[model samples]
Target: MSQTSFQTPTNKIVLSISQLNQQSRNLLEGALSRIWVEGEISNFVRPSSGHMYLTLKDDQSQIRAAMFRGQNQGLSFTPKNGQLVQVRGKVSLYAPRGDYQLIIDHMEEAGEGALRREFEQLKQRLSEQGLFDPAHKKDLPDIPKHIGVITSPTGAAVRDILSVLKRRFPAAKVTLIPVAVQGDKAKTEIVHALDRADNFNQGQELPIELIILGRGGGSLEDLWAFNEEIVAQAIYRCKIPIVSAVGHEIDFTIADFVADLRAPTPSAAAELVSPDQQELQQRIQDFEQFFVSTIQTQLVQQQQKLTWLQKRLKHPGQRLRDHQQRLDELDSRLHNAIQNALQLKKTQLRASHTNLLRVTPTHRITQLKNQQNNLKHRLLLALQNSNQHAQQHISQLAQRMHAISPLATLARGYAIVSDPDKNIIRTSEQLQVGQLIETQLHQGHVVSEVKRIKKK
Candidate 1:
């Protein structure tokens, strides 16, 4: 091989910036195809296009990461700034800016993940100990005379519970036991309140049958107090039925597992404890109507029997002259009274039957059929009348046509004389001497020629 043919100019080996960056990207991507990085998320930006851009940083350094819309859409939770997260992605360099970025495919909370694992472990342990057993769970009262609410008095949870209780059943007496629902003191306050409520309920003559221990929606940190073991133990030891409503529907706590019943929200807990007044009133009204109807029906039946007996009493047979004669009168009176009563009942039943039929579909259908037939007959009669008028109009038009027809004139003893072109000559002025012409009469046409012209 020639030296110059195989070798390039060696003075300087220059490369395009794009080519350099492209090779670098391929190298970086290939070297670290898939890896997991744990860091605190910062400067998270989500634009209208749905792509999430953020910086994953630790104590020393940070790197840009992008989670495209396709991968991030299935996430159960949203990522925020300063959140500890573990992300799986591929490393790549941007050719345009010569910058490196990880193309993240998945993400989850780092610190929260550990907490959730612990939560699951504790749940399993408690479940094995029969803490969540249904046999141990007491039934909620149908109508709790008094309810004790253990939560922060100033929190939205208390307001929601109070409003729902008042709306559903105003008769229920509510006692609010103020407690902290979050922070380091939240667990202790809740445990103490549960104990105090239990003591109060036992000491008082009119005891509360139900206890609602709960709070509102929040992050895992904000709701960690409910997951404390001491709070769960307190709920387990309480004699009164407890309703656990710690957060929104998605959030659950250890207290929820140990309590007699778990409601999704404080309002829902209130609803569970209180019977709806409107529904109760409707039920009462229905029962009353049913009772009254039953009583009236029985009374009517009894009245019919009593009337028959009264008739027999009013027409008692005369004192017996002979034993056989008295027996005959008694039998006759009994038969007649029974027959009258039966006849009256049959008449009333027939009236009821007729009234029932009047409201039935068959009766309405028959009535509608009669009305439809009537309308159909009227339409046919109108059509016949219209046809008759049309026929009369046609006869009048025929008479008018005949009156204007030239044949009518010929029929009246007059002939229509025309020149060879068939133009009628109405007057002698239209006639010319020696002009061939034809005369149309009533019966036939005659050929003729004008022999003379006369004016008169």
Candidate 2:
């Protein structure tokens, strides 16, 4: 029976290369959905699509990995060969090449993840303790006369800050308190630098009005000094306003939140502390003009007052002379008045004498009677002219009234027709057959009934 069954095997399982690869990919992906891998970066390549192709390797083993553009863009530091890194991704297989790889979603420097976790924890604690309270922050001087810089003396950050300060505001004196920016000594040095800058000058130099605590851009580990708790405390406790400018625009540390102000770069920090030269010049010019204008206005006001006072002022001698002149004028007026009165009396006496000689009482009475007759004739003529004017005015008024009178219009062979309700019939349509209406003529009115109507 076994020999009979061994004739042929038609049901043997077979698969094409593509099918095999696809099945293998499905199996691998399903089995290992997510995992964390740590190794040194190698064969790093970034294609035009921004997708990163790299190989992760340990001492004895290596694996291909891919970090797509979307996932890799959020990394703070640039990746390079030989750099140790940690990646979180899913296991995947490339069917076309039949190669297996890790599809990385997140990646960072190996120690950076732990540092960032610590950084966040510290930041949370500090925030809860109110170290970053706005009330604790001091306002930056409008124009800082003395600026203290805390950074490495040989680092690019100091150079950048000095250059900006020189260009923007040379008047401000910069005092450099050099400190190590990175490594084991960085945090302590930074804290000491902050303290020295805060308590600057025991009458040795100008006191620091503002402090610039900054460093150049770097990886999270390189900028760790600014993230230290002691450094944050120093910044918080410092009486002088501190401007933290560590790393690039995208990088943030605990110092940034605790300081009075945060600048994206060291140069930006310098610009923040120091006022612009051109702006100061412009302000000085404005103040100069205001002072000049104000002085000129006050001088003009005082001059006007002086002129008014001069007009009102009089000398004592001039006042006596004026009184003398006034007395003389009054004496002359009194003399003229007496002379005129005497002359008037003489004229009256002469007139009385002439009346006694040329005319009697009866003659005077006749002259008065003639004058009265003349006045009466004039009055009568005036009355006649006034009456004539009044009659003409009345005639003109009568003609004007008659011109616009309705009775006058009716007298011109036109009759006004109205309904029985006294409503004017403007058109024949207003009249209906058998409706009673009133017709107004020049002298009277007649009531009539509407007959056959005609309209034109």
- Candidate 2, residue 440: CA error in Å? 98
- lDDT for each candidate structure: 0.90, 0.90
Cα lDDT of model 2 overall?
0.90
Alpha-carbon runs more than 4 Å astray in model 2: 1-110, 314-456
The TM-score that candidate 2 achieves is: 0.48
Best by TM-score: 2
In angstroms, give how far residue 49 of model 2 lies from its true place: 42
RMSD of each: 20.1, 17.2
lDDT of 1 at 111: 79
Q: Write the per-residue lDDT of candidate 2 for residues 61-172, one digit (tens) a residue.
A: 9999999999989987788999888899989899989999999999877777568878998999999999988888889989888889999999999999999999999998
Model 1 error, position 58 (Å): 1.7
Tens digit of per-residue lDDT, candidate 1, span 255-323: 998999999999999888899999989999999999999999999999999999987663234433455
User: How many angstroms is residue 234 displaced in model 1 relative to the true structure, after the best TM-score fit?
Assistant: 1.9
